[model samples]
Target: MEKKRYYNDNIGPIKENEVLALKKALELCNEIGDITQITLLIHTKGNTGYLERIFETRNLKDFFRGVKIDQNYPPLKIETVRTFNDDWQGKKIVVAFGLRSNELHKYDDYENVAGIIAHQWSEDSVKDWAQSWGAIDLKTETEIEKTALPDKVVQQAFIDLTNSINMTTGITHPMDEEQCKTYIRALKKYDYELNSKEIFSFLTTELNWESDNANDVIKLIDKVNSGGYFKGGAKTGLQHHIKRWKSK
Candidate 1:
């Protein structure tokens, strides 16, 4: 099956305004006690390369952990790096980068990942998914940075506001086990040979699940298969269940 494309426009070079916004967002995350890590979501490989060059030029690559490239549906390239300032002694913030259409749910897999920075052109669906999982939306957070208040004051206010609304608790896997099993069964019925990317597409387009939720189901499938509880793992873990469902 042909993979569905979430974004159609080619991302241009990172603009100055975007850089300011990114810096502001990173600064906020750096100052807030609850947000020690962030993931940068981009839409294209060019954007990923642009960001890499920018980070390198700015000496931001010094904190890099690694990079991952996914050639599947909604193809993505990720760079995991850390950010810190001298003022904030003993504090280092981890920042990850990936395609916006990829697994927003995977943010939870990292420690202290309470923040997310999406490219300005990111779709509403992606932003909403991030918000639903309790990750701080950098766009919204950066708006506060625009205020005239002192940095410390704005940081404190932002902290208090997020705390009141419970935004700092970190990401959550909202899809339960049964739901995941159902999704797996659906995938088996769709095509037993489907790869992980195709399974994600099926979950999103056929099952009407948000991308994040679909990705959550995918992770659950991996976990169950890897645990050795399911025979044949992802290749055939729930074939028996799928056959029964198909007959019904």
Candidate 2:
């Protein structure tokens, strides 16, 4: 099955005010060790105002050394390089976003950046998928660096969070042996194939528990136990399985 596209361009045209905010984003990136360099190439539609307009951006001019402003194209483009994998080791992963698009995009993947390379590229749509699923949107050199806690981390995080919910509320989401087995199999193929949003959908209607929050693994366990947040005197504390895995 084809993966769903993560974003749609419903927002209006881009504004210089918004681009100005890129300074703050750049600062944040530097703080997070997200980027070490900036290479600017401006292609502007034929406008005499373009030259002065480009130079007027005080914030962008200060940080970047390669500011090439052109009056021959559409909206401006921004790209970055950041570290991504063991193969490239310390290479940059390149993410690009254009003035026409409202969001940045990444194209880094193991299959794409699995060798001696300088950068990995990803599109805005793929970045959308990751962000929609709760992953950080860092369109740097490493494709997966902007992680929603890669599988191992997610698994361990899941365990900790679920465990905490159990202890605090004395409620546990019970999963039958078979359900757990099936879930593990799914995880092997798709740790993020299903996300909190998808899993939570099941909780609200199908489970008949009337919950707005759920997880594929934890929800299964919840159904098995039938011990719940409402019964435990907690409305949103329906996170037993996830919280439990977190404390350790």
Candidate 3:
């Protein structure tokens, strides 16, 4: 349950080649007043199940969200330069990093490209950033503060968390406490109903809980759905579960 470290030298040393590439990319952004295309050789953490969706979206906002970030941050348009990493045999992915090159500029709304790289290029940083964005370890079953944040931002956080879940490797970045609460609250507030599969998916993938732990969450949800005596009804089920888990 320890928080993952991002922006640290945890992904092995950044090779001289990668540093040079990063420098070149940064230089291009400075010259063009936008992101420019630069090639990078990335060492994979393991399976590459999530690369396609990440590239398709061109941003990690779906998996991680930030607030009050540097507005002048340069946006990036990324593509896979190659699938093979020369240094690691075939385990790494070669990616092309660039400024926003697409016609649609919707994905360009981010703090900056450097911040994005800190998350995308490194696993520890992704966890660290997630922590910064208000994710918590579900195992702890802690309370998630509403932060008086706007509803839209919380909703987006839920959506992004789901998107990341759909592409998780089961051990990379897990949801934080705030994210867990946001998702549960959103579920309760939804006009429609959610099936068991949907509920299970959220617990297993989104929260990255083991089967037993996920089942516990489902039971808590069932208790809430059945109209328990909690003050706010099912919306408070999460808190009850947290309290019980903590007591045990």
For each candidate in turn, the TM-score is 0.34, 0.26, 0.22
Tens-place lDDT per residue, model 1, 1-248, is 12111111224444543454346445554355443233344443344554655454543333344332322211122343222222332222333333343444344233343344444343343443343333443434322211122223222322332233322221132323443454444444455432455444443343345455455545755654555233222345445545444454
In order, the Cα lDDT scores of the candidates are 0.38, 0.31, 0.34
Question: For residues 92-150, what per-residue lDDT tens digits would candidate 3 score against the true structure?
Answer: 11122221111101111211222122213344333322232233222232322312222
Lowest lDDT sum, 10 consecutive residues, model 1, at 1-10
Candidate 2 residue 133 Cα shift, in angstroms, is 4.6
**Cα miss at 65, model 3 (Å)?**
52
Q: Which residue pairs collide, candidate 3?
A: 5-124, 6-125, 35-99, 135-176, 136-176, 136-177
Model 1 whole-model lDDT (C-alpha atoms) = 0.38
For residues 1-248, write the lDDT of model 2, one tens digit per residue. 11111122212223342243333334433443423333222222222122234345435433233332333211223322332222433222222223221122223222222111111122343333344333332233223322343344345533433434432222234433233433333342233333443333332222322121233344544543453321122223335433443344
Q: Report the C-alpha displacement of residue 97, candidate 2, in angstroms.
A: 2.2
* Predicted structure with the largest lDDT when compared to the true one: 1
Q: What is the lDDT of candidate 3?
A: 0.34
Native-vs-model 2 lDDT?
A: 0.31
TM-score of candidate 2 on Cα atoms, chains taken together: 0.26
Flag regions of model 1 displaced more than 4 Å: 1-12, 34-48, 52-98, 120-125, 134-248
- Count clashes in each candidate, considering only residues at least 3 apart in sequence or on different chains: 0, 30, 6
| Residue 133 lDDT (model 1) | 35
